[model samples]
Target chain A: MDPSQVEIPPLKDLTIENITENVHLINSRCPNPRLKYLMKSLVKHVHDFARETRLSTDEWMAAIQFLTQVGQICTDVRQEFILLSDVIGLSLLVDSIDHPKPASSTEGTVLGPFHTHDAMTESNGGTLSHDPDGEPCLVICTVKDTSGKPIPGAKIDIWETDSKGFYDVQYAGRQEPDGRAVMQSDDEGNFWFNAIVPVPYPIPHDGPIGKLLKLLKRHPYRPSHMHFMFDKPGYDHLITALYLRGDPYETSDAVFGVKESLIVDLKTVTPKQAKEYGVAEGCRLLTYDFVLVSDEEARSLREKEAMTAMEKLGLRMKLLDGLPVPDVD
Target chain B: MDPSQVEIPPLKDLTIENITENVHLINSRCPNPRLKYLMKSLVKHVHDFARETRLSTDEWMAAIQFLTQVGQICTDVRQEFILLSDVIGLSLLVDSIDHPKPASSTEGTVLGPFHTHDAMTESNGGTLSHDPDGEPCLVICTVKDTSGKPIPGAKIDIWETDSKGFYDVQYAGRQEPDGRAVMQSDDEGNFWFNAIVPVPYPIPHDGPIGKLLKLLKRHPYRPSHMHFMFDKPGYDHLITALYLRGDPYETSDAVFGVKESLIVDLKTVTPKQAKEYGVAEGCRLLTYDFVLVSDEEARSLREKEAMTAMEKLGLRMKLLDGLPVPDVD
Candidate 1:
């Protein structure tokens, strides 16, 4: 302990462990125990990642720049960084571990980067596709409980792309919500609608996330599909999409939303059956059944839905209660 | 399974559960298993947090806004968000769990948000405080092994504030790296320098971190302290700071960098002792000793330092071997 025995300090020997240890010391001195623990844990992991990788200065700066671009790309309509999470699979992993669904229900998928709050409601069997130039098609679906009983008065919120593979929102000027509709089923748990067969398309690629994917040598296409969110009381809510069979990107969906159970056959209908469904002869007709799980599964689904919504919107705890709800449009 | 028993789709009952479950299903279809797992997990946590708090649309947007601001505020020199992490203690927590330093050497603390690479090197007994306008004092320190033997030829990198409590970096024009020095210990593990004692001061408050603290109703002051990073061949590197005794903000240091063992007293020197050390009579002197652990500890310290340097410089693995080191200003 003699003052004469003090050694001078060295600079180059700086390491992650020392940096983190210093950070921990600060954490231990914080006034709030919870904040302290939280900060300490975060610093430790971040530093560890840096140390394990032997991260270089340029790489660190690049990361900082990537983060900066992620912020800049965020706007009211586009959340490319969140989409980055979708592509990276961080979002889905969180969803699965937190929302363990029952075996009887359909699996959930990502709420892709492009979900808006404004779709016009329509009567049962109403057409979501307003464009006459698109290929004519009919969609018939059955809603039932896990035990095979029909669920009366179920609702189907549906959306799809035009034949050109563009959503109404994507071509705001050209389309008037052409492929978006909300319809309620009748007493027989059946729902039918007329629409155009959606085509496969590429996600917007002008942003940083797109650039990153390109850098990674990945494609940016999603298979043709119809988005659906089905709901009935006492049954698990289902947010799902039906992908068309034989789509090229089925296996390499840019956002990774494809499932074997979700692929459906679009059958060429006869003129007689077409007349009955109010569609022209040779039009494609697609039919599928959506089975809802029990009450417990339904609850989990609800929890998962809430979590997904929050994450997409990037809602933090402090702003949860008093912030105004964003306009769905 | 009869077609006649199928129920129609319903619209009104589409609860949050359906939305979440649907999202989960799509997530499971990702091509890369790792990406799928990560996305699911992130989505689940985000959604759960949202649902648990009932976050509204506005609240969500506000969060997005906050994150955006966090990104916007980051730059080459100022990293307010990182400071936020430091204050919140995430950085430290991560450090501790990653590098469990043995209890022999000085415990680590946070590397304050502001540090420059170009510190002036000084010979033995060289004073860092060129403008000695504050509490005039002599700093005497020693480095020793666990057995209390001197560690010969150790290096000590030291930095602190002037009597007015301002680092050289804080005032661009006024200081020439004053109050910062790199020196080597003699054969006896002893190092001494004459300087002015630093006073407590406020961290910069013009940036986003300052704005956030203000929003949270918190102060922005750190206790007076001298920074030290000591290293020897056979022992662990020591990254530490010495807090001034009786500082008003010791308990509430903005970045929480106070440690009980690191605090030291500034004693007034007698006329006789001042002459012996060839200093002015009635000057003040602060003395402390640094003890280093074995080689393992030193290796950990070195690792942490390298990691931090890499993080600061933004280096990556691909560039490490052939990359040229940046010129330190």
Candidate 2:
């Protein structure tokens, strides 16, 4: 590259007051408008955060080391960074912002770190977990649009911990997948399955994130919950969870995943209801209806949100010339 | 622990607008005042950044993955996190804010990852490197206070790239150290040594930060320079580097380490000067002085900066409530 053609700001000797301007000027050369905007905002916030903290060298170095540890402890099945983000409330914030919905549609929550693509595929009324220790549960759920029309063949994936508050994947040398599986709704937009009532359990907190929780004097337990994800062609995909009612950790969930609309109650199965569902003598029951929005509606809502944010910033800013124009705060 | 004993807000089912508030409320329980402030500011900036950019789930996940890779790639020999911080300009910002100086005091810069405490100690006029392929240069430098009183017995640590634009530690299977060393000044506040004239080089790319630089269309080169550190009891420690005058990359250092006052010139030594310094024919000469501030003065400046920052925030906020009150952007 020619020295004369270099696009970053001609900032040679950066001082404390000028470093931020230099960074912004250099980023002004980015060709992609969206990326340029993201980078610019990121730098401004980070710089402001440091200055506001008056962060010392020792403290700053400690943060660098902490991030390094969070990265180093990650493995194929475990994600320490995601757990960190969840504990810090970032995952939930992003989820809520990205997946806005109407009052009638089901709300979305965090897709906790236990999700995996290898769950066994099953059909309605089939068993999801076969642990002898867990009490049986019968799930009766349906898929529909905002207007209540049945939408058949919706894919539903569910995963949760066993009665012991431990997912099968967390066990040492685990032989097979348990307490988690995938199934599709029937042609009548109804699906039912046999599983256990999941209890509240602690997140994986033996890593740097765990250390951080201890430092903050906060516990590391998430509320009792059963994870669910729904997907169908021409409809928005929903990643949400159902928190069992009366759980002690419900209100102060470490990840803040619980919602008033998502908290659900379970009932003792009657004899007739048990026979109809082909469940064992002692079983609990859960009934729910998931409402989804059309693809066009979801896209329109996203655009509306972006426009609102832009108006809040009071910018009629045109991004077509390539470099983003968001001023440093 | 009893459910009623939890100190965080009794917030359940958080919404987009409420999530930030919930985070701040929960963090209000921290016992350490300083940590509470830092975490509060950090979350605000991060959340504000996400909202301002309308960050999508896909982009957020991509960032998580990028940070994970950065951590995974690190080992005893590499520090990718520090490199990341340096390139994004946070390291320099923190350094400058933490170490503000008057006009007469020397400025500090990024302490790049090449620094290690193992450099061999040498005396004045001794050789720092034994590379047979590079031209030799003699350094004549002194340490003093802002009042121009020479400070004797000051410690100086110097490190630089060889003529090949590589530090001694950059090689594979290398035996002895080269191009870096540590020593002290004599009673007269002067120290001199022989070493190669370092050239410009690129930072460690080929990782996430490198990929980011490429995406931003930014180069990875820093200008030719030698690193210097001065230390003494009751005086502020200085970590800085000296840029060679007229280097092509001078104006666009990748790490943003170059400053006009920190850049210096080198020229051919006169025969008498060469004889006095006991240097071989054709060796170049570099002469400079480093000024430091006392610990008391440094503390006062830091307090002033923090007060100014507080004023900018319009906060006469008291931190004794065991909670920090920095507002979310």
Q: Pick the candidate with the highest DockQ.
A: 2
Model 2 segments beyond 4 Å from truth? A1-5, A317-329, B1-5, B174-176, B317-329
Clash totals for all candidate models: 115, 1
Quality of candidate 2's docking, in CAPRI categories? medium
Worst 10 residues of 1 chain B by lDDT: B6-15
Q: What is the C-alpha lDDT profile of model 1 across B76-111, one tens digit per residue?
A: 446655576555544443333333355565666666
True contacts kept of each: 0.07, 0.68
TM-score of each candidate?
Answer: 0.56, 0.94
> Model 2: per-residue lDDT, tens digit, A186-260?
888898899888788889878899888877888888888889999899988889998889988878899989889
Q: Rate the local accuracy (lDDT) of all candidates.
A: 0.63, 0.83
* Distance from true location, Cα of A77 in model 2, Å: 1.1
lDDT of 2 by residue, B1-329 (tens): 33356666687878777788798888778877778888888888888887777777888899999999999988765788999889889889888887888888988899987887788899998888788887789989988888988888888999988888888777878677778889898887899999888788888787888888877878888899999988888888899988899998888998889889999998878899889999976898888898888887887787777677777877765422222244445
Worst lDDT window (10 residues) for model 1 chain A?
A3-12
DockQ of each two-chain model: 0.07, 0.58
